[model samples]
Target: MNLKSNYLLFLVFLMSLGCATNPFTGKQTMAIVSNDQLFPASFKQYDEFLKENKVVEGTEDAARITRVGQRIAKAAERYLNANGYEGYLKGYQWEYHLIEDKTKNAWCMPGGKIVFYTGILPVAQTDAGIAAIMGHEVAHALANHGQQRMSAAYIQQGIAIAGNVAITDDESRDLFNQYYGVGSTVGAMLPFSRSHEAEADRIGIILMAIAGYDPAVAPELWKRMESSNTPEFLSTHPSNSSRIAQLSALVANARAEAKKFGVTGFTE
Candidate 1:
């Protein structure tokens, strides 16, 4: 078999063996790197980041970040347990920190180390809005989006290497590199990332609703994010319009889901 074909077969084999079911989505996903391995490494990296960055604390905003994160975490635990996936967070050591940064971004590391940037606070505007953002970031971790992204990166690199090995001519290789770079990234990786973002949005609204935050606020947050523009096809995340529309559509369903957990009222 050709080198490209060989790599394809190997990828198929890896996909067959390295799969984990996401409790939230009830879908099998790639997990070449287990949480046991990903978590410790992520924890160490998070610790190093904390040492390097100015982590905001001892203030209302900082406290709000932590409070919102804890509520989301509790909602996750409750959802998992109620859905027959108790102890799913066996190694999760959830930690939330507010960092002093101007970047409008927040992220949750693989094992639940979350950092909320100061810049995103203005956009969030309220405690419930903060919960909307927090839930989305946490959902990324819960759904193992990091693991899947890493697995996709591995596949991308492997395919590049296989193509290099199979194509010999200099001109052919240059053409291959030029096209492959854009094709793999725009076609394969960007769509994968956008899907993850949409999934996180879907799961997050439900989580925030269960945690007593109004899911309707979620689309508003995304509408605010629309000012930061990136074309949907080229960006790692779905377009702001797409996010707002999806979250808006899911709000009623999220509220209904929250009602199942006896959460009737939501903060706005």
Candidate 2:
């Protein structure tokens, strides 16, 4: 490689540097997008979505949703604060809403904006189940997983642009970009998403435990989720059976985590 190529490679490496850990998985990950840059974008999009959707208010489900969300948020704040991540959510504006849509999902954005669909309520089944999902989704936000994925995408885009400049043939550049997109989207992005799902499950278990929920119920909820047979990728969530198995395996440890948080008389 020539000096220019070497320098460019070094620049790319430097851009990949700044690190953050997954709060649940305890794994160091590349965090190219700063929280400062990510939160505003998430907040704006969340607000726009709320404006466009029918947000239900003053129902039993809505009340339960808010209560569960607040409990998990408190648990998250306590865990992060105790671990010296106090200011991580400093500018976060947390809000929760229940949407009347029948979609079988819930999501919490980076700045703590939450949306719950009506369809998910049946499978959620109980307060602990709702806490399970909230804990998992909020864990993703706190871990900055979305920001990490965005940063990785930007890096891949930069590489593709550079490759296109170097390759004179349009077909060759097209091929390069196509291969890059597939490799980055599937190889990197999908697996990264899967990692986030697993980490969130672990974190969610602990948060539920701390919030006085029987963490054991989390596995059963996942079992319900698995029975839903929702298409994984299009739906933007994990498979029910996979999550169920993972949660079941983590039960013993989840109970231990609950003990640390002084959770007693756990639901049987």
Candidate 3:
């Protein structure tokens, strides 16, 4: 067989061997790096980050962060169990911390380690708003986005290596490197990230609703984010306007889903 055929077979094998099911979507997704490996490294990095940053503690805001995060986590477990994916969160060690940072951002690592920056509180505005943010961040972890991203990076690197090995001409290889880097990022990676964000948004609203927080608050939160000058194209997240519209459309369905979980009333 030719070298090109070997590379193609290797790529196919890699993809086939590194697949896991997304509990929420029930779809097969990339999982080149297993959670057993990813979670320990993620937990260590989270601990290191906390040691390097100021973590708010013993305050009302700090307590609220933990409270909302726990509720979202419970909602996730309920959803997963109800959908026949019991014990899906067996290895998850959930922890939430509010960091004393000016950046209006929050993130959840692979194994349920979460950090919320202080600057985002003004944007969150209320408990429901906080839940809106919390649910979205938590959904990312629940959906295995971090694992997929790492797997995708491995695939991207593998493709680059194959391209380099195939190109004998030095100048052609150099040109391929430059164009491939930009093209792959803009054409593939960005879109992959945006899809994750959107999936998180959809899952988040359902979680917030099940947790007894108004899913309607999600669109409002995005509206505020839009007013704060969030950009659109070539970004990792969806444009705020599109997010708002999507959330608005999903609010009724979220509420209905929550109703199935015995959560009929939502607090704003």
Candidate 4:
């Protein structure tokens, strides 16, 4: 990288620091990737995953997932449009799926490709329980966490690339890449996943409230999630107690957020 190119990259980095305020907390959030750059690949990958995965047929559960996802996606769109990100979702291909798996987990990939595992149905004890999980996962996708994780990995791999250039052989380059991959996954990805979990808990409350589910029930859903505390590696979520306390503190604020979305008559 020449001096001018290096300066240009730095300028790119600075320019990428676009700000979008969080509607729930009325706070600014750090966002690096633009929706213009981020949406296309996410849409492609989401379509590919749907084609490959065993997407559940439109059963009652599947319908529920789709319904909840659409509601949340719309609420998110309203938030973005209201806050001047009017075209942020112009290319977003929102999707939802329910898979017949027994693992107590659910996730929404980038570009709104969501999955609900049958195994998690027990933990998601009710419609509200499902809403809790949906809110959290939708928040992750909306916040561009998947792209941020990839960007963080790119930085780690870039350092390994630097190390490889100093070495003599392709074998050494492969070794460094392997090490970088492992180190990034264990060190950066886990912590990043944990942060997503925490942020989801916080953001999820307001989302659920805005969608008119009782945000107070958020803690109760977390209590159910607590029943299975696998190792941190096995489970990417925060501990139950942590989520419970966090959501409890945000109930008032979640209600306040609900009003912004015109959600009234929510349970206290």
Top lDDT model: 3
lDDT of 2 by residue, 84-120 (tens): 7777678788899999898889999988989999989
Worst 10 residues of 1 by lDDT: 223-232
For candidate 3, the 10 contiguous residues with the lowest summed lDDT are 225-234
lDDT of each: 0.91, 0.80, 0.93, 0.75
Query: lDDT (0-100) at residue 266 of candidate 3?
Result: 91
Per-residue accuracy of model 3 over 113-216 as CA lDDT, tens digit each: 99999999999999899999999999999999999999999899999988997899999999999999999998999999999999999999999999999999
Q: Per-residue lDDT for 91-173 in model 4, tens only?
A: 67788888887888888876677888888988877676788889898888777777666665555555555565555688987
Query: How many collisions per candidate?
Result: 0, 2, 0, 0
* lDDT for each residue of candidate 1 in 12-34, tens digit (9 for 90 to 100): 67766688899987899988878
Residue 189 of model 4 has an lDDT of 72
| TM of each candidate vs. truth | 0.94, 0.87, 0.95, 0.76
Q: How high is the lDDT of residue 254 in model 3?
A: 97
Candidate ordering by lDDT (highest first)? 3, 1, 2, 4
